[model samples]
Target: MNSLTAFARPVLRWGGDPSGGAPYVFADPSDPQTYTGFDYEFAEALADKMGMQAQFVPTDWESIVSSLKRKEFNVIINGFEPTGDRAREMLFSKPYYLFRLQLTVRKSDGTITSLEDCKKYGKSVGTLVNCAASRLLEEGKYRVKGYQDPVGAYEDLELGRVDAVLMDVAGEMFYARSNPKLKPAGKPFQTGAYVVGIRKADASLKADIDKAIDELINDGTIEKIFRKWNLWDDEQVKLRTATPPAIEITTTKLNWSEGLIKLFKAAMITVLLAFGAMFIAVILGIPLAVGQSNGGPLIRALCTTYIEFFRGTPVLVQLLFLYFGLPVIGITLPGWLTAIVGLGLNYAAYESQIYRTAFQAIPERQWQVAYSLGMRPILAFRRIIFPQAFRIALPPMTNDFVALFKDTSTAFAIAVWELATAYRELANATQSYLGIGIVVCCYYLAMSLPLAHYAHRLERKLQRKSTGILSSGAEK
Candidate 1:
């Protein structure tokens, strides 16, 4: 029965990010269980024209192309621009929708009115990462901040975090248009068209999608979809007659050495964020652990509550709250600083548990021995109790430090641009995910393996010292 059902209706899987929101693919605010957008309508129409059932596969916008390459979906129907770098990695169908760059700024910002003004004044512009607008900003040497989505960039613009936002006109239409605080700074520029992306090996699928797109255009179906979404304009009529502007293939060869250097720099950021966060974790963890182990009821309750609250919530949410939510309260932290503080606070909970357990594991005899030797409580704790507890906690602490390296990838959410972000950007640009991924893995292993090995050796050496000390005490 399953086989027959599969044969009866072949599925054309198209992928996109609904979080990108509105006019492209998004949850219908009126009915979120179903998606509604020009892209969604077009996908359904294209699939129907091809005698197949449409299946929408939700994917992150950053890894959409890579997801297509992985065969997670049959085609990418997201707002993918045909670039030479992308063309080398995949086949592009006939242009589906015309698009151009729109610059948006806060209504009160009179200092920056246009892209030229942004450039002349050295203003910061925000755009989606790894997209054409970001590349254009980079080429023009403007201060550019990249967000995971258009909405984020627009939000930052409204918050005055960015002087302007340069993104696709569609982004402005859906996000900035409704916001009374933001206005289009200048006329749209940089004409481009959205195209469906298929894997390079899927020539037959490409041909079929192209045929379907042509049919949709010829039959006025595409126009109807655009009109329904209020996206139809004089510019889109050109899609019927005009070929998409030629994709300029970059002639300059990719410098693997340069790419490696960039990845190395990003890896260093990962290291620094991890180290800084872990340092904070250790500093705070010790106090919390000590408080919980030996303090009044109030102190113990506070420490326990702090530990439980941070441990229960996800680190990503904490980071987002620190970076985005805090800005609402006039507490704006830089991305890297927020990442460090967020991760530190989250991990300190676990670290405190580790320390508390180690503290408990120490026999009462140790304390009695220190007191018998006439050592003060503080001196005994510093010289004997802490040293012993620290040794017991060392292995786990090292393990947590190693894990922190990978967790630093979450910094990408707040735009710290750590090793993981570097890998994604490089992989997308070079279309060499396998090679770049292996290099990134090697970089992580390089950072982690040494510490792990040293921790093991130190643990064994400490065990030996401990055993020898016991033997000496017995002999004495």
Candidate 2:
């Protein structure tokens, strides 16, 4: 006890989505700076039991599993379920809490009640992506629409965009409770337990966590934590008493051919998304840049505002707003269209600055020479100014194109599967993060390397031409 008290706090980091709504892991409504949830308290308690201090690591829920595989955190305990696919990748502690799926729908909608009914009628059901509920819906052959957050899913149900939302009982209870419009449609289905996902290679860590979980349950600490969050249930109480079997460790063969085929197919989508977005950005950015540079005060202000607004915000937020948020006001865009437009508009702001800078870099004497030659403003720009600016901008433009190639992965926010998403799914299933990560990185490099090489050659060619022009003038 003296040795333990003498030591400093040892931090145990666990990742979760604080914006993922209440009773799980979210910011305190009363004090946004502080986080309070069942998972939050449970993590703290579990960490204390292990002679450590719990530190909540906020992560994007969509890629949370991959984040774990990357060792961003010691464990994933944000109501994570132990699935066969996940088990192959990570070790899990005994069940800490049990939950079941709840179908949330509009109170007015009395026709739909169960997953089977929704599937038979082809109703668009909403759920969080890559979760047990979503997998259940997909495996049942139901038309499932995935959201980044359960709040968004419930919002869709409220706005009549989706017929129903399939989420965990706790999420539905916390998020949909006291809502006049939405209600839980039927009894919970597919009962499951929440387990702590640990690194499979770290068997010692897994054993430590399992021991801590047993101690928490034996001492009634886990139950008290659940009661504090008003999440105590009979199944969870039963889970505390029940003995859990040891986690089975398994290895999967690296099927490079099949993985490569899947990667190439998804990479095609990445290429299309990048090309389509880059086309719009370049086309719009040139004009916007010109306007920002030469236009009157009002036009400049408008152009500046457009550029800052898109550049200031995140691309993912814009994609989600366009694809899901707009439907609330009756504007529903297709996924591909939303991905391209959102990416294009956001990047246009950045590209405009590049264009403007390149335009300014060219000598003012060039424009004067064009005017002196009796050339009109439009002709001066087309014949002389644009060519030089294009040369200056080409390098940056190539860099931006390469950047946008990787950025296309953000399209996954709007449910467009690209290379990154492809590898995440493949890596999770095959438990081959290192191998798959290398391959995916190679795929990106394969696309960008040629563009970079060409850019390098173009720059050198232009440099030689400029030197020759200077030498000719000096000789004359």
Candidate 3:
């Protein structure tokens, strides 16, 4: 405990709050990164004053509060907006920055004129789970769904899955500016204040953080930090502007199962896609491999070129090229089709290589001997080459199949339903471990058990055949 306290890691949950005021805290949609915003700069300045190296670690926004409450960190230094109710759960530093909470609907969505307008349309309200807008809507009559991050909410909104995304004024602006593909709703709802949250019991740490805020405010450091991320605009310093629910809502029990089902569905899709693609790849691969190795120089060059192209690029790029770019050039495909085709083609290229190595091991003399014995080329291969190659290829092919199954989950980007997507939906919605556990078990059983059984059977069959010859022909 002493050693741990002396070098305790101060972790802050980024992307936790919905305002997205700190551009640093907003998660990058294209990457696995979460950042700390300009407000986080002030937090770092405090660590410097205390002579402590504060290493910033990003965690799930939804679960961060519980982690902070449990003392996962010495402090929750990410910019946190504390409601009076939330204040009961955690201590608050002085309000470092005031942000305007806004209601953002697609500019094309025409119906949502105000925050209250969402109630009339029966359009689901989108917000970060546990975000301020979510809490406000929880007590109101609007159908609200809390998502894992701003991107999720924006995605749901853009897809028309939700009528509007509730965020602070600056956030809606940032998102709108960055993604010209999306249109923000007509106007924004204004809110009162946002602050940095800390464990309530840490009155000492609270004082330290609160004191830091005071210094920043007095020295203009707060102003500089917000300016850097473009949060210092009217939205950052001002607390109110346009809309908020007239009355607070009391949240109801979420169905939670709907979220679970969505998760399971996603995982199943991924498993099937990967499993399906690998099966096709393995089947198709054998022919290409055989052709490349034995089909003169021209066919070998063609096969080599195909393998290099697919293996050289990232799987995601391949998927996108097939789904998005191909349509531009006149080849239109369905989402599932794109996933299956892309995955199959890519793995086939790799599988061809794997199979080639084993197929080439058959002695060139064997083919000549078979021909000398008057066996046709096809008969020679069927009766001699393939059976031996199969035994040799078994282990490596098994290993490849195992990896391909996991790779199937990446089809989520193409909107292909799979295990990984399902778990992501579940993890975001239920915000629990249930879906994750189920997915882990499902994939493990799906990939490992069948491969294990097949390997065992193949090994046994190899022993019995001992190269598929009826007799060695040398009398024992």
Task: Pick the TM-score winner.
Answer: 1
Question: Of the candidates shown, which would achieve the greatest lDDT relative to the real structure?
Answer: 1
TM-score list, all predictions? 0.88, 0.73, 0.62
Model 1: residues >4 Å from true position, as ranges? 1-10, 108-110, 116-123, 138-143, 242-253, 453-464, 467-476
lDDT, residue 92, candidate 3 = 66
Ranking by TM-score: 1, 2, 3
Model 1 scores a C-alpha lDDT of 0.84
The true-structure Cα RMSD of candidate 3 reads 7.8
Stretches of candidate 3 off by over 4 Å are: 1-22, 25-37, 41-168, 178-181, 189-194, 197-203, 207-260, 283-291, 294-302, 305-342, 363-395, 409-417, 421-439, 458-476
Cα lDDT listed for each candidate:
0.84, 0.81, 0.65
User: 1-476 in candidate 2: lDDT tens per residue?
Assistant: 46576268788899988886578889998999999999988898899999887889998776777898788998897888777777766787888887788998899997888877897778889887767786677556687777778876787688776899999888988888778998877788777778888888989988888889899998999889888877788767666555553322222344689679978988888888899999999989977897899899999999999999999999999998898778868887667778899899988998999999988777777788899999999999998888778778888888898899989999876666589877776675556779999999998998889878988899888776562212112211
Error of 2 at 139 (Å): 4.6
List the candidate numbers ranked by lDDT, top first: 1, 2, 3
RMSD of each: 3.8, 5.4, 7.8
Give the range where candidate 2 is weakest over 10 consecutive residues by summed lDDT: 467-476
Backbone collision count in every prediction?
Answer: 0, 0, 19
| Model 3 per-residue lDDT at 231 | 71
What's the lDDT for residue 222 in model 1?
Answer: 91
Two-way TM-score contest, 1 vs 3, winner: 1
